[model samples]
Target: MARAHWHFPRTALAEHYLNVFDVGISSHLAFIAPRRKGKTAFILQDLAPAAQQQGYLCVYASLWGDPNAPHESIVQALEQAIDACASESKIKRMLSSKVRKAAISNEMLGRVEVEFANNPKSAGTRDLTRIDDLVTQLEKAAKDRTILLLIDEIQHLATSDDFSGLAHSLRTLLDRRQGRVKSIYTGSSRHYMHLLMSTQSSPFYHFANLHRFPDLGEDFCAFLQNKMASEYGVAVAMGSLVKAFGDLDHSPYWMQRLVERLVTEKCPLREAMNYTLELLDAAEGFEETAKTMKPVDRLVFLELADNGNPFSRALLSRIEAQTSNKGIPGTVQRALARLMEASLVSQIKKGEYHIEKPGLRRYLEKQVGSAPSR
Candidate 1:
């Protein structure tokens, strides 16, 4: 039997962005969402396909695709997009190289692999220069239609000093070709995303219109219900599905896993929800992360988890009482810095922070003592 393709139609959202581009409001767009929220899948499956149908040359580059050097990934994706546009034969060759035969499955393609070219020992100025040239080539190749560049994990460029020059070059490219080249950038880290866009010293500051990528909403829940009933004869309650979705932080990736347990293992809804929560906890390594925190940092995390204001006098008093140390602003600042460094929390603004992981609050509540309501 052929493998089933499960997709949620986010093409309407994509079209809305394109319309934003059409209205001359903002040629560039940026999406900020937490990890495993299906941002990449939305780009690859829905947005890219929609753009293609509308005669836009869509190219996707993931900065983290090459951990050692991210510029290589950008260069490779642009080159592939150029190749696909150059000739029909070249596109066929590229597709053949990317798609492979499955061993024992009816699936025609195993997995599409995107291979990046080798980078030099130090990929600094040279790679950045090449990226600039590649963008120009892609623009030239896209004669009539616009070239849509979808960059994933774009926060990587802003986080590391090594890619600062590339960031500036990218900003220059987008600025120079505002009408011809439109780009959509997606990042999992709001903290880094803010650094990229909010800081005056950053290259991409105010480069694009920022939009919060929404979670899989009721439509996805309805899709899950219909898919379950039609495909596996499993009629799960809508509320149970919605609860599982909420428990998993509205991540479609984990929701699929919960549905899989219901279908394959015949697990009840409550048991599957508990199992999914276990999987989520294991994946986040919350317990291990808490073990690494210093006593004061852990206390600060608990305080923030309970929605206590970090800069409030009440919080300082609680911190001093719990840690038996003078709860000066300097002490709280240091603890907050450490928590942000551990990726457990993120500073949204001055003296304002949020837990990066949604499930982290529940995890901390179970491990540590609970606090007063927000």
Candidate 2:
């Protein structure tokens, strides 16, 4: 069993579902959720083992690149994957040599070259060319093995071509009789991903194995309980911990923070509940100020949080009117713009909005629930 904090067995259910799907080839999976929900951990836990077991080369890319381009992100992930898989001395030696060679001979470099022992003539430049070259390199890397490409924060990818190109490139590899590649695409912003993969204009339309990383469930909670018992040598009150999760309101980040605080304080579960509420109360003024922001900003925050985790623009507008007594469309939109600027709300999907904070939903729920039953 993996560490309770780092791995989720619940992901196995997703893997099983993907394997059973009739998508007709190696599946592209998207694990979508809000931030700090263990989506990245889930990807790492599953993708790493699958790559090693299937004898596949895995590239885990972060889209937040040096220049913030999709292509750059891919290259970064490639270099990392190569360095990680390469023999330690060999990688250091090869990279050192590549840098040395590039510096010494200024050969009209339109593209950068990462040459391996088996493939010497490869020069990768431009996004498309680099992906093509990388695929070639990955093929060489996975001699008698499969290849797995795991891209994280894929929502940062802009343009239909960015994703479409990826899908088309993967299609080429999968179409081959000697194919040895599988992929998992993950993003924290589900709304953006839906627009990318589900939209008719998207190159990745129907190209991925859609998977939702669920909240920590009973089994995971039980795992946490066992870990607490063994690690601290104290039997945790499982019921209290469960109740704590409910009270923290099912936010994974907050849930983890609560556990950390409990462990640090050595507080009993019941005591921890009181302590947690106190923490929330202590932080309320600042949090409320953070929400007060501007009228438009506050409106956007409330709209997203109150409407749902994510709401389409139309839905948001509808709710704005329903909730506002002013009945001014321009006023509501301006308020939303302010919220977006303040970073109190984020557009997870194009033309859709979502709250960026945890525990905020409950605060809004109470406020709305008490509003003259409107």
Candidate 3:
């Protein structure tokens, strides 16, 4: 059987961002969006392709690809980009070196191959220096063409102390290159992305234009409905498809799963929607995660969910009463730390927090009756 494919048209938005770069509004940009929202897909499939067509050398990297050592991915991507611009003989020599281990695939370097490496340690100063040198080499090799770096999960650089030197080196690279080297940094965590771009102490602070990546809206919904009916011979109602999309917070990643269920299982739309919700809940580990939290932490989480101020005296008093604690400040502080460590909450700024998973709020509200308050 042939593979099914779906192409989402985001070329217009891609062009808009590139145009911002071309006009000198900013040579670097930071795109913010939640997980499973197709940020990576838009970058790899749409933006990179558009930039390449506009005579730019695009090198794509994902920091999350190697959670331990993201710089390795950056190094590999730059090396691949350098090879892409190398002479035919040089490319052949490079290919020859690796051919004995694995077959030489033409498509591997058709665009820069972004792959993760297994290095237990975080990137050191030396590794960052090497990446900086590789960027310089790629820029030189590209001649007059602009080198556009599309970095995904860029928040890791800011959140992880190990990548500080790399972040500085990258900022310096972009600073020196000016118009010649541009970057599009994408991250799923808005809180961490803000840490990268908003904190004055951060290396990338105010370094790039920040934009919230829009969701795959009505167009994507209609496309999925039509594509399933025409290509897969699956009949799914448009309203049900839209509802499924909404139920998953408009995530194309999950919507694709719904489409697969509809086509392969020949399930009814309602059944597929329920299955998708189950998959999402399971993926989030909703109930299991809640069980692990202490009562104080859960209460603090509820307060954040209800948009209540964690630092306010009234909220603190309420938390104190609920948890039977005397030291409200210390108790709340520890709860915040524990919640953040579990990835359930994110500190947007000093005295402010956001529930990392919005769906978790709904789940908790369902599981715990009414919202907790002062």
Candidate 4:
């Protein structure tokens, strides 16, 4: 089997945007990226580095809430982060001494504090009295400065109204303490974040610097390739790289999975290609793209996904040939408009429509035939 092309590996953010995240550049930065583009990785890699270096307390909370009670997710995450930062002996000592001093029973705190010796877990399991005390402790712990609150997939947090109220509460504390607390919000859902910020009526409007993670580029691909060669000894050739990129639908997470598969299976390039395509077919959104779309819409996307990445209207017309016997140009345009509105396709480079989602692209290509662009 032939050696397949492989792309350079680097964090998605390291691909485009460059900044140290210093003063005046709003401590609040909101990250938006396509799903599986390493949004969480960026949180761990890029943001965590700066926060740790600055000696800032970093609290990571998943915005995806529980169905039962979701209101205090961030608050809970912060508590956990604080607890985890404590040393094991320190936590044990604190629990024993604090409980003894307060005359509190072991049952009140529930689980042993030993489990929460990790940074985030420490505050996570605290009782109500402990929660009130934790806030005061954090205020003192910060040396009157702010703790960095990092929330991941923030769009999951209730709504802007509820989040705004939380932000307002945080703001009140920060204002009173004078720069003792800061926050960074991140989300993978671009449309949801846009909706939250588009209206000034929302509480979090203008709250953070909106930074978009761009597509993986040559540098990132190169880094990834070298890392594979050095660390995993997987010699991914240029051909495999191109093939992987073509099949990847351009998501970092899937790309990483591809790398892991290659290294683990020791599969030949041809086998890897087949495996990658299979993975794409089995991915989450592919079924819906193939099942839900109108035939014309599916054909339009298939052609775009295959040929132009961005295809011409003339090309779209050709793809929709089955329905064109009706001679309805306005109807055809509206169909494309609907696909775009549904985010099934996006304008790649003016006039040229491409399937916006990687899963959709693979599904469309696999189902309907795609006409090569002229």
Instruction: Please give the CA lDDT of all the candidate structures.
Output: 0.76, 0.55, 0.76, 0.54
Candidate ordering by TM-score (highest first): 1, 3, 4, 2
82-176: candidate 3 lDDT, tens digit per residue: 97676545533533343222212211312111222234466677887898889888878988788888888898886667678778888887788
Ranking by lDDT: 1, 3, 2, 4
Q: After superposition, how far is residue 297 of candidate 1 from its true place, in Å?
A: 3.1
Q: How accurate is candidate 3 locally (lDDT)?
A: 0.76
For each candidate in turn, the TM-score is: 0.86, 0.65, 0.81, 0.67
> Mind giving the per-residue lDDT tens digits that candidate 1 earns over 1-374?
12126667787888988889889999889999987787877786678767877888787777766745777888998899897987646644543343221112211211111212233223577777888888888778878778988898788776667677778888887788756888999988888899998889999898889999988898899998898889889899888788778888899878877887888877789988889888878777777776777667766887787788776798788778877567788888898888898777888788789878778777766776644222
> Which residue pairs collide, candidate 1?
none
lDDT of 4 at 274: 76
Report the C-alpha lDDT of model 4 over 64-123, residue by residue, as the tens digit.
433122335555755655665555344334323422422232113222122121222111
- The numbered model that scores best in TM-score is 1
Where's the lowest-lDDT run of ten residues in candidate 1?
A: 103-112
Q: After aligning candidate 3 to the native by TM-score, how far in Å is the CA of 359 from where it should be? A: 2.2
In terms of TM-score, which candidate is stronger, 1 or 4? 1
- The C-alpha RMSD of each candidate to the native structure, in angstroms, is 5.5, 10.4, 6.4, 10.7
Per-residue alpha-carbon lDDT of model 2 for 262-373, expressed as tens digits? Answer: 6677777777666766565444443454446543344456656666432356645654566543435565566667665544555645667766554655555455534323
